[model samples]
Every structure is written in structure tokens, then in C-alpha cells.
Target: MAGLFANDSEQIDRRTSRSICDAVGERLQQSLRPEPRLPTHLEQLLDELKQRDRDSH
Candidate 1:
């Protein structure tokens, strides 16, 4: 499996990759709208599921 992935020269440096990812993530966050709030009934159902989960544990 030697050389199966990016060779050393072809690989991106960690710092550069992190900065690039951060910029992209920031742009994505800016472009997306907040999701609509859940309906009351769905919220109640979610609360019930959470309670059942805690009870089981």
C-alpha cells in the first residue's frame, strides 16, 4: 500500500489546509439561513423521546 495516498510533495501542509477549510466554512455559514423552528407537537415528541432515553439509562 506504499504511495496509495498523496505523496509527500502532493500533500497539503496542515496549516494551509486548516486555513482553507476555515475560510470555506465561514462562507458557508454566512450564506445559509437559520432553519425554521420546529412545530410545538414535534418539540413535545422530541422531549418525550429524550425523557424516555434518560429513564432507560
Candidate 2:
């Protein structure tokens, strides 16, 4: 029953579909950044954790 599973494969060209997806993924990767810099207020909290670790040792 290949016909049951297969329908309208010819509606979209495979190469064009692949290129569109690749371009979209590339644009998203370029626009996204990881871990923005922490604000100054958080610095003290980070320092406290460091001190706690030091004391634990």
C-alpha cells in the first residue's frame, strides 16, 4: 500500500525545501546568543557562593 502512504510528494521540490530550512536555521543561529552578561546586582550573590565553597573545604 505505497499509494496509501504516498501522496503529493511532487507538490514541493526537495532541493528548494532543504535550502529554505537551512537558511532559516542559519538566520536563527546568527540572531541567538547564549548567556547574556549578568547584571552588577548579581555579582554579590555569586561572590557569596564562592565564599561558601571556600568555607566548605
Candidate 3:
């Protein structure tokens, strides 16, 4: 009987651990996901900067 209970407890622990890992993995993926392209104004600013750098050199 004790052995059975121990097995059940271990199984529950494994499931809980897996659930926590999955949740963490999902959150990490969302945080690491690539953002959409920069806004048009930002893009333009970057382009201007690049042009200025090239001209300066």
C-alpha cells in the first residue's frame, strides 16, 4: 500500500512539473517572439541615419 501511494505521488509530481514547464516554455516563446516591423517613422529615421553615416564617411 505504501508503495502504491508513493507511485501515485511521483506521478502527480511529474505531471505538475510538466505543466509548470509547459507554461514557462509558452511564456518564454511569447516573450522571445519577434516583434512586427518598426513603425514607418522609425524606419525613415533609421534610413536617414544610415544615409548620414554614409555621407560622413
Candidate 4:
């Protein structure tokens, strides 16, 4: 009976630690995530380049 409780305690501790690590990893990912789109000035430059390409064609 004592051995069973010890095993259960270890499992619970492992699960708790894993959960905490997972939460911290998720928050770090959110904070470190890059923007998905270019800035406005870069977008305008790209658009102008695309127009020039189309005109050349």
C-alpha cells in the first residue's frame, strides 16, 4: 500500500511539472512570435515593384 502511494505521488509530481513547463513554453511562444505581415512601408514598396514588373511585361 505504501509503495502504491509513492508511485502515485511521483506520477502526480511529473504531471504537474510537465503542465507547468507546457504553460511557460506556450507563453514564451506567444511573446516571441513574429509579425505575420510586412510593415506598411515594405508592403508599399513591394506593391510598387509588382506594378513595375507588370508594366515591363
lDDT computed for candidate 1: 0.92
Model 1 Cα lDDT, one tens digit per residue, 1-57: 677665787778899999999999999998896998999999999999999999999
**lDDT by residue (tens digit), candidate 4, 1-57:** 677767654566778889999999999999999979999999999999999999999
Q: What TM-score would candidate 3 get against the native?
A: 0.49
Q: Whose lDDT is greatest here?
A: 1
Q: What is the C-alpha lDDT of each candidate?
A: 0.92, 0.85, 0.90, 0.89
Cα lDDT of model 2 by residue, 1-57, tens digit? 677647775456889989999999999988885778788879889999999999999
- Please give, for residues 1-57, the per-residue lDDT of candidate 3 as tens digits: 667777554566778889999999999999999989999999999999999999999
Q: With candidate 1 superimposed using the best TM-score fit, by how many Å does residue 33's alpha carbon deviate from the native? A: 1.0
lDDT of 4: 0.89
As for model 4, its CA RMSD to the true structure in angstroms is 6.2
**Cα RMSDs, all models:** 7.7, 4.3, 6.1, 6.2
Candidates, ranked, lDDT: 1, 3, 4, 2
Q: Is candidate 2 or candidate 3 better by TM-score?
A: 3
Cα misplacement distance, residue 44 of candidate 3 (Å): 1.4
Clashes of each: 0, 0, 0, 0
